[model samples]
Target: MDEVSPEETPSQKVPPWLFRAILTGAVALGGLYVLGWLIAELKMLIVIVLVSFFLSFALEPAVNRMERLGIRRGVGTGIMFLALLAAVGLFLWAIGTVLADQIGDFADDAPGYINDIEDWLEDTFDIEVDAQGLLDEFQEGGAVANLATRLADNLINLGATVLQVLFQILTIALFTFYLVAEGPKLRRNICSLLPAERQRQVLSIWNLAIDKTGGYIYSRLILAVISFLVHWLVFWLVGAPFPVPMAMWVGLISQFVPVIGTYIAGALPVIIGLLDQPSTGLAMLIAIVVYQQVENYLLQPKVTAHTMEIHVTVAFGSVIVGSLLLGAVGAVLALPAAATIQAFLASYLERHEVVQELEDAEAAQHPEREPLGDRLRQMLDRVFTPK
Candidate 1:
């Protein structure tokens, strides 16, 4: 080969260190891409596990109380699960009974309501409206008929969705049982793997997370109960049929679900109220509005202040972010997740130093400048002087 400088040599063209660094970066990026794909594939499993994690916290206090009463952790977990199952069964039974009754009522009164709607549209807008004719058109092949077909298909899909939800609930129960029963052992095992200082830090964080999660759950439960009782009274006063079930639905849904929960919860009662009597629905809507304002301004801050340790805007924003990222499960867990993160940061994150400098007074900084009020007064004196 012709004489070549080191820079022209093949080995020098790609330096060994640079080549290795490039290879390492490519490997890391490839690994991350693979991890993302894997996570996407197991998203449903991740959701189930997250739900289980939340349930573990929700059931933890009950299990701890049982453990304090000298029950084995396993037995405590079992008792807790039994109670939960019984409560769920009772809730389901109540919902089923009320829905069956109301569905019949709705069916019987639907035609009259439809006629009322048609009459109102005609009178208000001076447009001819048809209830029976619309049904006839739907029965015949048309755009409305296509919509009916799609709705029927959706109803069929609803059964599958319900089954999936039941499966998720069962999976969550199993995970929560294990997590509660073996929690101590799991902590010990994890601590055993770390150095003494790290072990202490890890254990402290774990306890903090549990404490925050438990407190949030308890606070939310109290708020939900209060909401249920107050709304139940309001519904009863308004003479809404199925007030008890409606109240329960509103309380639980509004408290557990974030952001739009109040609106969604209120919608059902208002709809029922409207269907039963227009004035009742209007009153129910007004009552809902007033209660929401009171709750937002008063009750929410008081109940959740200590437990959440986050601003109302932060809490609501987190729920929206969580929903966007992971749907309903994310929304439900967002508060606890945020609390845990905040607790960790408070404990371990480096504190920001306070500045020693004092703020400069505007008059001192600019001695010739007169205050706005004095300047305005001087202008007024000049304009309105006895000249």
Candidate 2:
């Protein structure tokens, strides 16, 4: 107001250091943006590489044992792969036979199953849901029909892109083969790049990962076998058709796939039950649920903990985190990755025992006015008990 002095605008008179800082930040941000774009572009390749690494780690133990018995690594890997392929081929044939024989029966009986469900709903919930109308709509262009159409379209699109998918698979297999063949040499070369102490640490982590991956496969196989036997017995007692194949399917799928695997395995038997007789379906459902409870509370924690050496909370959390980060692929790889990190940290971190204070222990043991820790302990005991 008082004859405003010749003033420089803020930008025109910016501090030299401030300007330099802004320029540096802009450059860093630009570099980060470029890096992010590159990663997004190559994400599929990244997934393939990770899958190959996981396979190599998982198969390393089998390859090593083969080597110990005087077989070459390359030949051993081939043998293991052939055995796996043959097993898979046999399973597929079993599934095909089951489907071919049973699908027509299921189709023929679907209406009866729907009528039973409709009657049950009316009796129990007093709700009027039109089973036939719904089925007609579903057949004639309802949401289900639309979904089926879209799925068919997607399958066609997938077929168009099959070559690329096959190429990616081939690339992964080749990389895994090479990795297993030269694992020791590769480890030595990598370790040579570090200090002796760091080298030991790296090798220790590598060995731990291999052991854990192999252990994980072994544990899953054991569980799968248990699942197969239990399911086979239940199906046979209930007079379900194709008991062997259905049980085998449940076992393999429930073990290999996470989260929804049990439900998926259970659904087939239930569907067959409904097709045959409504009561049978209900019984099968009850059995599946009961067995699942037993496995969750008794078998799973013991077996998985023994192999993984991780807490139940950690195992569950890792699966969720991995599912979030990498879709299905992440879920499959998360356990081994988490086990490796946990083992590595254990190597370096200090160990300590946590003893409860005497007073706290006394308070925890009190019948009434239970502490939160005591309540939690009780809950855990219930969740983990054999009963």
Each candidate's TM vs. the true structure?
A: 0.80, 0.77
* Deviation (Å) of 106 in candidate 2: 4.4
Candidate 2: misplaced stretches above 4 Å? 1-16, 106-156, 353-387
Give candidate 1's total backbone clashes: 0
RMSD of each: 9.0, 6.7
After superposing candidate 1 on the true structure, give the runs of residues whose Cα lies further than 4 Å from its correct spot: 1-13, 114-160, 356-387
lDDT of each: 0.83, 0.85
Q: Whole-model lDDT, candidate 1?
A: 0.83
- Please write out the lDDT profile of model 2 over residues 214-236, one tens digit for every residue: 88888888899998899889988
CA displacement after TM-score superposition, residue 239 of candidate 1 (Å) = 2.3
Encode model 1's per-residue lDDT on 1-387: one tens digit a residue.
898655575754656698889999999999999999999999999988888878887788778888999999999999888987897687678768877887999899889989988899999999897778878877775877788899999998998999998898888888888889999898999999999999999989888778888988888788889888998899899898788888888887788777888889899889878877999999889988888876766677778776666776778888888889899878988988888888888888899765544334644576687645456558868999989
